[model samples]
Target: MILRTFGWSFAITALGLLAAFLYEGTTALGLVAVLAILEISLSFDNAVVNAKVLERMSAFWQRIFLTVGIAIAVFGMRLVFPLAIVAITANMSPFEALDLALNDQEKYAHALESAYPMIAAFGGMFLLMLFLDFVFEEHEYEWLAWLERPLARIGKLNQLSVVIAGGALAIAGGFFADDPGDVMIAGVLGMVTYILVNGLGDLFEGAGDVDEDSEDVKRGPNGLAVATGKAAFFLFLYLEVLDASFSFDGVIGAFAISTNLIIIALGLGIGAMYIRSLTVFLVRKGTLHEYVYLEHGAMWAIGALAFCMLVSIGHHVPEWITGGLGAGLIIAAFLSSVVRNRNEDGKNQSSADKELHSSGV
Candidate 1:
C-alpha cells in the first residue's frame, strides 16, 4: 500500500534529478537534490495538516489535488508568483522581470530579498492565525493539556483570533518590517485572507452533511444542482489557501539557495509532489487517526515557523533552524502519541481480564 501511494513520488524524484543533471551538469544536480530534501523536510508538517482537510474530500477531489494541484504548485506558485513579485517590487513589466531573472540574476535576487520583509510579515500573520485558531479552539483530545487548555479558554471570546492576529501584525510592522506601511498593508491583507478562507470553510462545512452518506448529494436553493458540489468547490478553495500559507516560507527560502526559477521549480516542485502524495497516504492509512497528537504537533510547528518568519523580517533566521524546529515538534508529538496509544491498549487488556474474572465460576 505504501509503495502504491509513494511510487510516483520516487519516480518523479528521479525525473527531477535527471532534469537537474541535464540543466547544468553535476553541481546543479546536487543543488537540486539538496533543495528537494530540504523542501520535503520542511514540508512534512504541511502534509500532516493537509491530511486532516483532505480526508474529508471526495475521491474525485482527492485525485484533482494530486493532478491539477501539482500543476498549480509547480507552475503557479513556484514560477509565476515569484515573477509577479519581482515585477511589482522592481517596477518592471513581466517580460522585464523575466529578463532580469534570466540575465541579471543578482539584480532579480536582490529585488526578491528587498521584498522579503513584507512577504515574511504577511506569511507570518497568516500562519500565526492558523496556529492560534487551532490552539484556541475547543479540542476534546488535548495533547498538551497545560498549554492547549489555556489557549482554548482564550479562544472562547468572540473575535479573539482577529484581535490576536492584528496585534501580531502591529508588532511585526512597527519593529521588524522594512517599509512599515507596505508591510502593514501586506500583513493586514494576509490576515484578512486567512479569515475569509476560514469563514468560507465554516460556511461550506454543512453542505455535505457528512453525518448523512457523504457520497449522497442534495439539491441547492438556487438551482436543481447538487449542494455538495458547491460545498466541495468552496472546500477546495480553502485547501488551496491553506497550501499557499504553508508554502510561503518554502518559496521564500528557496531563493536563499538558488535564484534560478527553473531549478527552484524543479526541486521544490518534486518535494511538493511528494508532500501531496504523503497527504493521500496519511488519509488512506489512517495515520492521523492512529496518531492522536499528530495534529497538535503540526500546529505547534506552524506556530514556530510563524515566529521564525516574523523574526526574519528583522533578523536572518537560517533555513536549517526553521526546518529543524518543525521536525523536532513533529517527532515529539509522534512519540507522545505512541505512549498514549500503548497506555490505552494496556487499560483495555486490564478491563478485559477483570470482566472475565468477575464472570467466571
Candidate 2:
C-alpha cells in the first residue's frame, strides 16, 4: 500500500533533485531537498484535512485531484501566484513581473513582501473560518471534550461561526494592520469566499437528495450522502481553494530560503505531490477511521496556523514555530488514539473471556 501510493512522489523527488543539481550544482540540490521537506512539514495538516474531503469524492475526481489539481498547486500556486501578486501590487504588467522575478529577484521578493498584508489577511481568515466551522460542528469524536463539546453546543446557534470569524477579522484589522481598511476588506473577502464555496457545495449536495436513489450518489465515510455531479464539482472547488489558502504561507515563506523561482517551484512541487499521495493513501486505508482524533488534530493545527498568520501581520513568526506546533498537536493526537484503541481492545477481550467462562468453554 505504501509503495503503491508513494512511488510517484519518490520518483518526482529524485527527478526534481537531479534537475536542481544540474541547474546549480550540489548547493541547489540541497536547497531543493530542504524546501521540499519544509513544504511537507508545513502542509502535513493540510493533507489530513484534504483527505477528509477527498474521501467523499469518486475515483474519477480523485484522479483529477492527482492530475489537474497538482498542476494548479505546483505551477499555479508556486510560480504564477507570486508573480501575479507582484504585478498587481507593483502596478506592473505580468511580463514585467516575470522579468523582475527572473532578472531581479530581490526586487521581486520586495514587491511580494509589500503585498503580504493582503495575503496574510485573506489566507488567515479563510483558514480561520475552516477551523471555526470544524470545531463548531458536532462530531462523533471529540479530541478535547471539555472544549469541543461546549463549542459544539454553542455551534447550534445560527451563524455563530460567522460571528466569531467576523469578530476575529475586526480584531486583526484594528490591532494588527497598518491599513485597517485594506486588511478588513481582504479578510471579509476571504470569509465571503469560504461562504460562497461552502454554501454552493451544500446547496448542490442538498439538491442531490432528490435523486439520492440514483447510482451516481453514494454514502460517504461519515454515512451521509456523498455528492456527485455538480455537487462533487463544488466540493472539488472547495478543496482547491483550501489548498490555495494553505499554500499562501508556504509560498511566502519560501522566499526566505531561495529567491530563485525555478528552485522554489521544483522543491515545493515535489512536496505537494507527496501530500496529494498521502491524502489518497489515508482515504484508501481508512486511516481516519482507525485514528479518530487525527482530523481534530489537523483542525486544531489549522487554527493555530490561522492565528499565527494573523499575528504575523504585526510580528515575525518563524516558520519553524508554525510547523512545530502543528507537528506536536498531530503527534499528541496520534498517541491519544493509540491509547483509546488499546482500552477498547482490552474491554472487548475481557468481555469475550467472560462469555467463554459463562458458556463453559
Candidate 3:
C-alpha cells in the first residue's frame, strides 16, 4: 500500500515537473519545485485538518479528490479564478482579461498586483475563521468528554462569532477592496462554500459504520441518502474551502515573485499537485492523529497570515516575515510531534522489555 501510494505521488510530481518543462524549460521547473516544497511545508496543518473531514467520506469521493479535485484546485482556483477576478474588477470582459493577460503581460501584472490585497484579505479571513473553528472550538472525544464539556458549550456560540467576524471584515474590506461588489460576492461565496461542504460532510458521515474498537472510525450520520449525500457534499466542500485558503497566500505570493500570469499559474499549479498528494498521504497513512499539534500550528499560521494580509491592505508586510513566521510555526509543530512520538516509543519498548524479563529471564 505504501509503495503504491508513493508511486502515485511520484508520478504526479513527475507530471508537474514535465508540465513546467514544457511551459518554461528548466528555470520554470526549478521555480515549480521550490513553490511545491514551500506549499507542502506551509500546509502540513492542512493535511491534518483535512483528514478529520475526509475520513468520513466514502471511497468514491476519495477517488474524486485524487482525480477531479486536483483539476479544480489547480485550474479553477489557481488559474481561472484570478483571471475571473481580473475581468470582473478591471471592467474588462472575460475574453478581454484573458487577452490582456496573454498579450499585455505588464498591464495584466499591474492590474493583478493592485488586486492582491483584496484576494489576500478575502482568502485570509476565510482561512482564519476555519483555523479558529478547529483550534478554539471543542472537539468530540468520547474518552475526553469531561474535558470537552465546557468546550462544547462554547462551541455552540460560534455562529455569533462567525457573524460578527464576517460582518466586521466585510466592512473593513470595503475600504480596502478595489471592487467592493466583487469582494462582497467572493466573501459570501466563501462562507456559503464552507456551509455547504461541512453540511455534506455531516450527511455522509451519518451513513457509515465501523468497529467500536477502531480509533480510526469516524461517526457517520444515522440515516442513509441524506447522510451519505451530505458527507459527499461536505467532502468536496472541505477540499474547496481548503483550496481557497491555500490559494490566497500562493496567488498573492506568485504576483510578488513573477507577474506573468501563465508562469504564475504554471508554477502554483505544479505546487497544487503536491498539496493534493500530501492530503492523500495523510489520509491513507492515518498520519493525522500522529501529528498532535500540527493543526494548532496551522491555525496559528492562518491567523498570522490573515493579520499580515489586513495590514498589507493599507500598509506593507514583508514577504520574508509572512512566509517565515508560517514556516516556523509548522516546523515547531513537526518537531514537537517527533519528540512526542519518540517518548511514546521509548515507553512502549521499556514495557515490552520488562514483560519479557518477567516471563523468562
Candidate 4:
C-alpha cells in the first residue's frame, strides 16, 4: 500500500534532487531539499483537508488530480502564479515579469512582498472561514468539549462564520494595516470569493446526491451512483483556489531563504507532489474516518495559520512560528486519536472476555 501510494512522490523527489544538483551543484540541491521539507511541514494540514474533498470527487477526477492537477500545481501555481502576481502588481508583461524573476529576483521578490497585505487579507480570511465552519459544526466526537461546545453554539447563529471573518477583517483594517482601505477591500473580496466557492461546492455536493430515478448513473447490485460532469468541475475549481490560498504563504516565505525562481519552483513543486499523494493516501486508506479527531486538529491548525497570516500583514511573523504551531496541533490530534483507539480496543476486549466467562466458553 505504501509503495503503491507513494511511487510518484519517490520519483519526483529523486528527479528534483538530481535536477537541483545538476543545475547549481550541492548548494542548490541543499536549498531545494530544505525548501521542499519546509513546504511539507507548513502545508501538512492542507493535505488532510484536501483528502476530505478529494474522496468525494469521482475516480476520473481523482486521476486528473494526480496527473493534470499536479501540472497546474507545479507550473501554473509555483511558476506562473508569482509571475502573474508580479505582472498585475508591477504593471508589466508576462515576458517582463519573467525577466524580473530571473534577472532581478530581489526586485521580483520585493514586488511580491509589496502585495503581501492583499494576499494575506484574502488568503487569511478564506482560511479563517474554512476553519471556523469546520470547528463550529457540531461533531459528536468533540476533541475539546469545553471550547468546541461554545464554538458550536456560536455557529448556530445565522452566518456566524462570515460575521466573525468580517469582524476580524474590520479589526485588521482599522488598527493593523497601514493602508486600511486596500486591506479592507482585499479582505472583502476574499470573503466574497470564499462565499462563491463555498456555495458552488455546496451546489455540486447537492448534485452528487444519489438519485434512484436517474438513468445516467451506473450502479452495481448495491445500486449506488457516481458523481461527475459540472459537479466535478466546480469541485476541481474549489480545490485549485484552496491550493492557491495555501501557496500564497509558501511562495512568500520561500524568499526569506532564496529568491531564485527555479529553486523555489522545483523545491515547492516536489513537496506539492508529496502533499497530493498524501491526500490520496488519506482518502483511500480511510485515515480521517479511522482517526476521529484528525479533522479537528487540521481545522485548528488552519485557524492558527489564518491568524498568523492576518497578523503577518503588519508584523513579521516567523515561518517557524507559523509552521510549528500547525504541525504541533496536527501531531497532538493524531496522538489523541491513537490513545482513543487503544482505549476503545481495551473496552471491547474486556467486554468480550466478560461475555465468554458468562457463557461458559
Number of the top lDDT candidate: 2
Error of 2 at 4 (Å): 2.8
**TM-scores of all predicted structures:** 0.93, 0.96, 0.78, 0.94
Find the number of clashing residue pairs for candidate 2. 0
lDDT of 4 by residue, 1-361 (tens): 7887789889999999999999999999999999999889999999998887877776777778887888999999899988987898889999999999999999999999998988899999989989988877999798878899998988888898988999999998887898999899889988888889888877766755656444323332223344466766777888887887887789899999899999999999998998989998998888998898898898899999999989988987999998999899999999999999999999999999999999999
Alpha-carbon shift of residue 8 in model 3 (angstroms) = 4.3
Q: Residue-wise lDDT of candidate 3 within 1-361, one digit each (tens)?
A: 7555456567767887888789889987877777766666555556656665666565566667767887888788878888887897799998999999889977887887777766766666676567556544665322224533564566677475477558756765677666667556656665666566666565445443333333323333422221134446666767777777767666766666666676677667666666666666776766656776665566667767766775566566776677788778777877777787898899999999999999996
C-alpha lDDT (0 to 100) for residue 60 of candidate 4: 79
On lDDT, the stronger of 3 and 4 is: 4
TM-score of 1: 0.93
The most accurate candidate by TM-score is 2
Give the Cα lDDT of each candidate. Answer: 0.83, 0.90, 0.67, 0.87
Model 3 CA RMSD to the hidden true structure, in angstroms: 5.3
User: Over the stretch 308-348, how does candidate 2's per-residue lDDT look in tens digits?
Assistant: 99998777789999999999999999899999999999999
- Between candidates 1 and 2, the one scoring higher on lDDT is 2
Better of 2 and 4 by lDDT: 2
Query: Model 3 reaches what TM-score against the true structure?
Result: 0.78
Q: Name the runs in model 1 displaced over 4 angstroms.
A: 210-228
Question: Taking the candidates one at a time, how many backbone clashes does each contain?
Answer: 0, 0, 12, 0
